[model samples]
Target: MPFTIGESVLFFGIISLTTIVIRFLPFILFPENKKTPGYIAYLGRVLPYTIIGMLVIYCLKDISFTASPFGLPELISAAVIIVLHLWKNHTFLSIGAGTIMYMLLVQFIF
Candidate 1:
């Protein structure tokens, strides 16, 4: 499907306006000089940990106890990520190494 110049302009104008509004909405609603609400502040403080926990659970949501390799690849990868994170406290290294290890394990080992 193709849009005419007018239609394209109108569509893009609405998209740009929406993007700008969403990007600035936080700043507009929560000014730097004003105190943020307790719930919002608490969410900012605690959401990262909860999000990480959710992601870890999501990653391990699939497992077959009776299958070949028996979830070893994922378990090993998780352990590697944990060790790397504790060893260096580096986010990129831990995730990168763990991802590479998991890719190799699934492709070659299992």
Candidate 2:
């Protein structure tokens, strides 16, 4: 189906307005002159670790110990991530290295 010119213009206008509203809403809600709420500050501090924990559980939820590969690739990749993070203290290096290791294991070794 094709939109008429008026319909396209209306659609784009709504999208542009929505984008502007979203961009400015944060500053409107939490102006620089006012102090942020305690609960919001606490969530900002806590959500990152909570999200990381949730992601770890999500990533490890499907391993099969009795299967052909026996979850070795996943376990090895996780260990690599842990070791790299501990040794170098770099989140991106550990995660990127672990992802590459998992892909290599699945494609060529497993």
Candidate 3:
């Protein structure tokens, strides 16, 4: 079966509208406030570490121990970032340095 342009536009519009609504509806419904719930506050505190762990795990998921290089630079960069974060408690600087280090390592060494 052949699809028409009008049908395609309608489908795309509906999808775009649905996506926008789903993405922003929660914010519109429940606006942010200074006083958040206890559980939410706890979750907010833990979520960054959880997200970082997930991201690190995801980056290392396909690494093979026997493979040459084997994403060692990424592992080292992550460790460096962790250390810097622990020592200085600067999120943006740690991430920026880690990313730059990783890119340089990849470009020069690997």
Candidate 4:
């Protein structure tokens, strides 16, 4: 079907507004209290691990089992970050080092 520019703008505007309202309505209407309930506190504690796990799984979902040099740099960088974080307990250093290593590896090796 042919769509005019005006119609496309209006359609997108309506969708954008609807999505914004739906996403933010709860936060706007019901402000959180300082003392959250037990269930919510438990959820807040668990949510970070859940989100990180989901993100890691999402990133690795497309990885091929067969060895490929293209994926080695990322794997090595991630391992460096993990090892540094585990051993040294330095979040920023781990991330910064891993990122620099990844950049260098990508620029030189790949």
Candidate 5:
């Protein structure tokens, strides 16, 4: 595709519009002043864990224990995630730190 003004604007406009709707839809559905339904609140609480579980499963799916790295980087990073999460109890911090550690290990050591 040509990087022309009209084409770029059309593409970005669609993306921006979609982003706005996705962001605003939550607020529209669950107003801050109003109480959320029990089911929705329950789902909100469990969704993070569900996503994390899915990511862990996906990450481990392609691992080859017999290969060179032998999954050491992944295992060590997972340990970091577990330890950080347990010690600090901050999900984002744990995930970010673990990701950085994994990247460093893979790039430098394994």
Candidate 6:
């Protein structure tokens, strides 16, 4: 199905407005002059670790220790991520390298 010109304009207009509102909503909610609420501040401090824990659990939930690979790929990838993060203190580098390593292991090695 092809969108008519007016429909396309409306669609793009809605997307643009949504993007702008999302980008500015944080500043509008948490102004520079006002102190952040204690709970929000606490969440900001704690959510990263919580989310990482959740992701780790989710990622490893399906592993079968009795299987052929025996979770070596995940273990090695996690080790690489830990070492890279510790050595360089860079989250993106560690996560990206770990993901690439896992893919390569799954495709070629394991």
RMSD of each: 4.7, 5.0, 5.0, 4.1, 4.4, 4.9
- Tens digits of per-residue lDDT for model 4 on 1-110? 37799999999999999999999985765467556667877886899889988998797777665766657888899999999999999989999999999999979986
Which residue pairs clash in candidate 6?
A: none
Q: Please tell me which predicted candidate would have the highest TM-score against the true structure.
A: 4
Candidate 3 lDDT, 1-105, residue by residue in tens? 266999888888999999999999747655686566677778868998889889868877987768978878878898989899999999899999999989988
Instruction: Write the residue-wise lDDT of candidate 6 on 1-110 in tens digits.
Output: 38999999999999999999999997899888999899888987999989989998897998889988999999999999999999999989998999999999999999
lDDT of 3 at 77: 91
What local lDDT score does residue 25 receive in model 2, on the 0 to 100 scale? 91
Arrange candidates by TM-score, descending: 4, 5, 1, 6, 2, 3
Error of 4 at 86 (Å): 1.3
* Stretches > 4 Å off in candidate 2: 1-48
Using all chains and alpha carbons, the TM-scores for the candidates as numbered come to 0.55, 0.54, 0.54, 0.62, 0.56, 0.54
4-105 in candidate 5: lDDT tens per residue? 999899899999999999999978999989999999999989999899889878979877899888889999999999999999999899989999999999
Model 4 residue-pair collision total: 0
In model 3, the clashing pairs are: none
Off by over 4 Å in 1: 1-47
lDDT of 2 by residue, 2-40 (tens): 899999999999999999999999789988899989987
Selected candidate, larger TM-score, 3 vs 5: 5
Rate residue 50 of model 4 by lDDT.
Answer: 91
lDDT of each: 0.92, 0.92, 0.85, 0.85, 0.92, 0.93
Q: At residue 73, what lDDT does model 2 achieve?
A: 94
Question: Whose TM-score is higher: candidate 1's or candidate 2's?
Answer: 1
